[model samples]
Target: MEADHEVAPPNLADIDVSAWRELETAATSPQSGFRFLNLCSVDSEARPQARMVVLRRADGPSRVLEFHTDSRSPKWRELSTKPHVTVLGFSTQTRLQFRLQGTVELHAPGSDQANAAWDKLSPWTRTTYTGGPPGDECGFEMIDEAVLPKPQDDAKGKPHFGLLIFRARTLDWFQLRRQGNRRALLTYDETGALAACRWVNP
Candidate 1:
């Protein structure tokens, strides 16, 4: 039995489309809760490493997501050694959670894709890779004034700028609402084709 005003559950087709639309919006909308996600990977010691990363790109059709990082960063090294990773994000506004398991493609600094992305970055943003390698100790004053790439030296951090391209193989999507809760597992094949969809208990 259902209440008169209870809303009907969304069909799988609708959920599939709406979920991707949310991801696309999350990538471009700064205010979106999902704009920042937790990316987790395994280090050499087989320990787990998790960091907050901005969602730089999300292509629903290709099931690909992108994030920028310094090649010298520990996470970059961890990813290079083990490409498999998990990404998680939640939106309080929508009461939605997305957990995606995937592998990553590293785009080196000088690669065509990396170059195009680097060219679009503002000088200030590019300055991040100019300092000493990530995890290096630095004084607050030095971080604020020193180690910044000179404005005219646009190539200063080119060698350290890199991109992590995530190709999701599965997505666990969940939504909570006053009236009802829903969950689904969507699996994608190597070509990014939806191979399976299953609704689960919320």
Candidate 2:
């Protein structure tokens, strides 16, 4: 009997590296073109939770991604328990969408990495994290004001902030066009090296 044969698909390395870089560029641009991602996490009960969040940074070379969130948020708790997550980003301008999956590493306030990132943030951006617990139930007619230390005045207050870092393992890129739908899927190895990639029908 003849042995069965299996055909291997195209590898991610075969795709144009420039195109992948361009996709990352569009995702991280500040013009609101690809600012938001649908962050997906699984709860303790295995229920999925997703929310739209701004993509703060993406280092393509290092495969490191960063996003900010209040330390007191429920997503933090969920992530604390389950470190793996998926981020879906769509760009209307280019009619492209990217889905990324990775394991998360949390950066507590005052850590060296957090400090470096904090130093680069603008005052207005830092103010968001200085507020009270996100999604808290404050009285309708009540206003509670807590004085937060200015970023310049107090260097120690950076610990109150939280930075979530995700090291991506897989990326699914899709392009929607009037003629037809195009898709490409890429996977990276544990060492952040390209494992394989392929173009598939959308």
Candidate 3:
């Protein structure tokens, strides 16, 4: 008689911790495909609004994430009134979906965070915030050339630039699979450290 040997299944703990670390790494890496996420905020009427935003920073130990935006944008008003926001992201390569719920703190033009972020922007990128407030109606007769900033000048956009700092309270991580799905809910303590992580039905 001969005995057969079978391969062991992959470890769950390694997958869980690696998943969290990958998310942070992706957000912080400029070239990463997962560097963008959908930021969801609520309007005064309680309707949900979502938009794509580039992830500027991610700090795992601090449970923080950041993005840049124009102070005149409608999202600024929405976030200012509500503070709390929901962020959704997915990586097609890894088949992972990350849902985060957090409160945002806005840094205005004069604030250090805003100023620092502004200083890092390239001149071409600075032109993005040079125009009038977002969603403003423009007369059809005005030619397209009139609305765009000239290549020579973009300094005026500085004041309109702002930074959004998000303090994540909880993160819901999910990975899809044919055999079985894995999901975990991670909660952060008052000091921003990971307080608890528990697997939930996917």
Candidate 4:
């Protein structure tokens, strides 16, 4: 049985365009509890790769989403080869699942956009990219995590840090409810301009 305080069933007849607004709002605000998404890309061997990434920025007007990563990460190579990617995310609070598809643009540390994002990172977060290149081979001996080199300033790890900007072309939004489900696809043009928003079978 559902809890007494659970949200009431949704009405499929009504389509809420605010879903996109809510998603952007949630992604930009960490307190909203929807700041994480699964970023999927295709590797050199044509295999799909997926990983959880924090949502750094979401611009509805431009249909762009930004996230941070280490320059040496495997996903970076994959994305460099195949710029197209799919992002899957869910908000447990709203019971909404979003499938986003987009092309990626990587910004190096010195770029204004990358520098702005780098300046906002806390010391600890910056330290994450300070270690040896991601995916480097380790010998059979155990290593001390405490002795890892730490970056003293943005300049130290800036070379290894990267910012990934995703230009979204489409979004498939699905809402789950006990009574019924609702789904819609919001498509954008090559320039990231909204082209159409239409409802489809869940």
Specify the highest-lDDT model's number: 1
Let me know the TM-score candidate 3 reaches against the reference structure.
0.85
Candidate 4 accuracy as lDDT? 0.80
Candidate 1 local Cα displacement, residue 177, angstroms:
2.6
| CA lDDT, candidate 1, residue 25 | 93
Q: 135 in model 1: Cα distance from truth in Å?
A: 0.8
Residues 1-202, candidate 1: write the lDDT tens digits. Answer: 7652377677876777777788899889999989999999999999999999999889989999989999999999999989999999999998999999999999988999999999888887887777789898978777455455677665788899999999999999998766667789999999988899999988
Model 2 lDDT per residue over 66-140, tens place: 888767788999999999999887778777787888999988777887888788877767766755577888786
Query: Candidate 4 on 113-162: residue-level lDDT in tens?
Result: 88899989888788777667877886746477766555575357888889
Listed in order, each prediction's TM-score against the native is 0.90, 0.80, 0.85, 0.83
Better structure of 3 and 4 per TM-score: 3
For residue 129, model 2's alpha carbon misses the true position, in angstroms, by 1.7
The number of residue pairs in model 3 that clash at the backbone is: 0
| lDDT, candidate 3, at 19 | 55
> How many times do residue backbones clash in model 2?
2
Could you tell me how far off, in angstroms, the CA of residue 22 lies in candidate 2 after the best superposition?
3.9
Better of 2 and 3 by lDDT: 3
Error of 2 at 171 (Å): 0.8
Query: Which scores higher on TM-score, 2 or 4?
Result: 4
Worst window of 10 by summed lDDT in candidate 1: 143-152
